[model samples]
Target: MIRSLKEEIYKFIHQKNSLYGLVALVLLMIYSALTSKTNADSLISVFGAIEWIPIILIAIGSAFFAMEYSNNTILLLLYKNSERSKIYIAKFLTILLYGIVLATTSIITALLLSIVLKSRQYNLFTVIAGKTILIQLGLNILGMIIYSLFAVAMSFMLIMLIRVNAVVICIGLAWGFFGTSLSTALMKTLPTISNILKWNPLNMVFISQQLSKPHYYRVSQLSNLQLIMGTLFYSLLFAILGYLLFRRRRV
Candidate 1:
């Protein structure tokens, strides 16, 4: 399991798409910081970049498995002595690790830039230590991590089922970008049946919003606990489904 995991990490690190994704993330972070006219805090930049995480993870997750299938490399891995479950688990871990690294780097980059360039007049350490900033930053980081896992699980399920990169990317992006609006519209349009769609993974991704806004229930029609539980439940549900299908899938 360790060997398989290591190989998965190594492959992810060497992948050109992964490298390109990092570059794009960095560019987006810088752009966001530059555009923040009033509030150019490290936390702001970090959160801004994180808004793109779902799209990034979707691209990474889809490509990670699809590449193997496209190159016929999955066949070679299957012939190795590793169990199918281990292979899928290794891939899932790779996605999780990448997401963590991406979020960590975004925070670090934002902090450095904030202190050195963005906030030259104020002491960044003091600002970061402030109660509100600290809490908000912590919540933002936590939300991004959870949502990243959500992206990984959902993308894994989609990619495994269709084995199509384009379709997975489209569905992932659509959900990431417009999911909240769609949910709201559904709730407004079908007030009677809206409860059924409220537990969807798309609605659960509003965790960041719920965390930042104390009055989130008024806006999202969901309590913080609901969002948290929904996120965890759907993430696990999709992951298990993906694993079950993957184990029996013919490479």
Candidate 2:
């Protein structure tokens, strides 16, 4: 398992998209900070850049998984390892590690930007929405960690089923951007089971927003703890199903 993880990490680092994704995240943060109209907006923009992490992670992860099959290298990988489970877990962990890197970059960039752009207005200890900015940032990061797990698992399952990187990426991007809206529409259309639908994975994506703004519960209809648990449940479910499909797939 350790060897497989190391290989995955090596490959992940060498992938051009990994570097490109990191650069895109930093650039987005810079743009958000520079364009903010107010000090509070600047702070929000810093963490707001985190909302894009799922989109970036999905694109990279889909391509990572698809490349092996598209290039006819999956057979070589299986031949080299002969343990499909290790390969799958390693790849998943690599993607999660990448997510962590992106999250860290966002937080560090947010701190630096806050210092440069809103030094007089706020600090990490400053209060926002009744909680310290530091606490809010931590909650945001926690929500992001859970969301990243779901996004990685979902992308893996989609790639396993779809095989085509482009199609998987398109679907993943759509979900990242509009999944919550779709969830809301469904709940309203099916008012009878709206309560149950609130636990859907799409609605779970709002964990980050709900964490930062406690009042967002009115929109998600779920407490922060419930969102965390639901997101985790879906993450595990997708990952397990994806692995099963991967194991049965012919090389």
Candidate 3:
């Protein structure tokens, strides 16, 4: 199982498109580092601008799964003596690995940018040292991981229902965005809706960057157990949904 999983992961990393995307991301990092303004507003603008990574990640995650199945390579794997269970878990881990890679890229970009663009207003290094940055970075990475894996779940889920994975890929982004935007808004009239929003995987990803900073938003005096419990519930749902879909899938 480990060997099979490792082989698939290796294949995922070596794919021509994946390699190119990594290269593009690296180049962007360099560009960001060099082009960063030596001012405060520009520094804030840089971190704020990184939301694009999640959008790209969602598209990539969908394509990653769809490409395997649509191209018939995944079906071939089933014939290679590997169990569906192993493959399912492998795919899950691969998406998580992909998210980590991208999240690392984002962090590296930010760290380099912070060093180059460090200022009185954007003093990330001085304001936050090793422990602080580690905490903040953990939140950022954790948030991205959740969303990216959710993308993987989405990609697998949609590919089973639709023939073309690209359609799902396109719709996944829209769904993700819409899901995130409506989560909090819907909670108002529908008390249940509010409870449901807590499990929204994208919330931590979108708000992690801001929430790490104390002064930015008011630290609520009230506890939010619903949100915490909802996250756990939704995560379980994502796993079960993927298992059910792939277990019965033609692949």
Which candidate comes out best when scored by TM-score? 2
Tens digits of per-residue lDDT for model 3, 198-246:
4445443334334344332222211333333444455567677867887
**Candidate 2 wrongly placed segments (more than 4 Å):** 44-47
Winner on TM-score (1 vs 2):
2
Whole-model lDDT per candidate: 0.78, 0.85, 0.58
For the record, the alpha-carbon RMSD of candidate 3 to the native fold, in angstroms, is: 4.4
Model 1 over residues 209-231: C-alpha lDDT tens digits? 56755566765677877887788
Candidate 2's residue-wise lDDT over 1-251, tens digit each?
99999999999899899999999999988887776554754565354665788878888998999889988999899999998999999999999999999998988888787776655766668887788877777777888888999989989998898888888888877887898899989998998998899988889889866787788788788998998899999999999999998999987
| Regions of candidate 1 where Cα sits further than 4 Å from its true position | 38-42, 45-47, 120-131
- The total number of steric clashes, by the backbone 3 Å criterion, in model 3 comes to 0
Candidate 3 backbone collisions, by pair: none
Clashes of each: 0, 0, 0
Tell me which of candidates 2 and 3 scores higher on TM-score.
Answer: 2
